[model samples]
Target: MSHGPTPSDVAAVYLQQGPYAQGHDPHGHGHAEARGHGAGGPAPKRVIVGYGFWIFLLSDIVMFSGFFAAYAVLAHATAGGPTGRELFDLKRVGIETACLLASSFTCGLGYVAALQRKQLQTQFWMFVTGLLGLVFVILEVLEFYEMIVKGAGPGRSAFLSAFFALVGCHGLHVTIGGLWLATMMAQIWVKGFKPQIMRRLLCFNLFWHALDIIWVALFTIVYLLGAGA
Candidate 1:
């Protein structure tokens, strides 16, 4: 029946002690309100943005889960059309995967440069990241073109439709990400490593890395396994 210390009591104590010590969260709100009320002046912009972006990433992953499920269920519904093994080119897929993974690495380096406030290094690394992403997108488009030319387009069969839906969705994200990278590059050029621009760069890094992770799964499930079959 003990309510323990009231928030006012805690606040008074926090004020007396000058904010809770590190590794201390008295009210179990993870020191968020404590910091806010104790002269912390709201959570840092990076933390807020990072948390929101994580939620967005989780929602994106859920959407991709649905696509993966659909592809699994319908991968076999070729209806006399060509199968994945016959249609997928593993060598090309491998190259695409390599490009994406490399872009992820460069994006990480760009993030480091942003943190260090290295203008030229950040721009150079981000430029490489964007170029690699562009290559990946181009390869994806070329693959789609080849598939369509071979009479295995999305309209040709349920399997092809599901394949295109899943793969094309990811490719669309990459395309959007590439554009975002361009925008960030412009922002960095104009604004330098301002807090807001750096926050944006961090979000872009997360988004690009998430896309890379999704592509890995896609390459494994849709490309590798499909190739084996």
Candidate 2:
């Protein structure tokens, strides 16, 4: 005699008729949802923001890489002008490095305070980060000024040209970062840890920390190595 529909048959019918059917693939073995398609909602704001910012950062790194390669190729083409050993001041560079590194720490603290919903602490830490970043930019400007006064400007030689291009690009980024830091602090003071502000703060933190990392490389390769050369 014919048997009634079994549990497996019932389950198969439900799969086809239920909500799962919305995302089900007719030809594929597994559901479309399993492949992160069909009816799945958009990713969280944090993930989407973070992923997009990372893509931007990677593109920025590629640009920096081009500057670095140019500097490496032209480091020795001084054309009788001052070399990095002659122009670079280790003590000043060391101080700039210290300021940037310290700013990175404060940026981290600010992010943590934001996460904890401590508005005052977040503002305070971000203020400190901005101050440190401003100091870095000032020191960089002074260094550039001194070099130009000594007739070692970018126009003097290929070596100086590359030097100014690479280091100046980094300094410009730091300056922009300082402005960003100030804007973030103002937003935190006014908005008080809103989700969108927090996402912007997170992006700022990533940006500030990335600058510190790039500065470390700049300090080591451009300053340290160049000073020794």
Q: Against the true structure, what is each candidate's TM-score? A: 0.84, 0.85
Regions of model 2 farther than 4 Å from truth = 1-42
How close to the true structure is residue 126 of candidate 2, measured as C-alpha lDDT? 88
Note the Cα lDDT for every prediction shown.
0.90, 0.87
109-183 in candidate 2: lDDT tens per residue? 989999999988988898898899899999999999999999999999999999899999999999988888888
Pairs that collide in candidate 1 are none
Which candidate number has the best TM-score? 2
TM-score of 2: 0.85
Model 1 is weakest, by summed lDDT over 10 consecutive residues, at: 29-38
Alpha carbon lDDT at 109, candidate 1: 95
Clashes of 2: 0
Predicted candidate 1 versus true structure: per-residue lDDT over 133-191, tens digit per residue? 99999999999999889888999998889899999999999999999999999999999
Give the poorly placed runs of model 1, Cα more than 4 Å off.
1-42
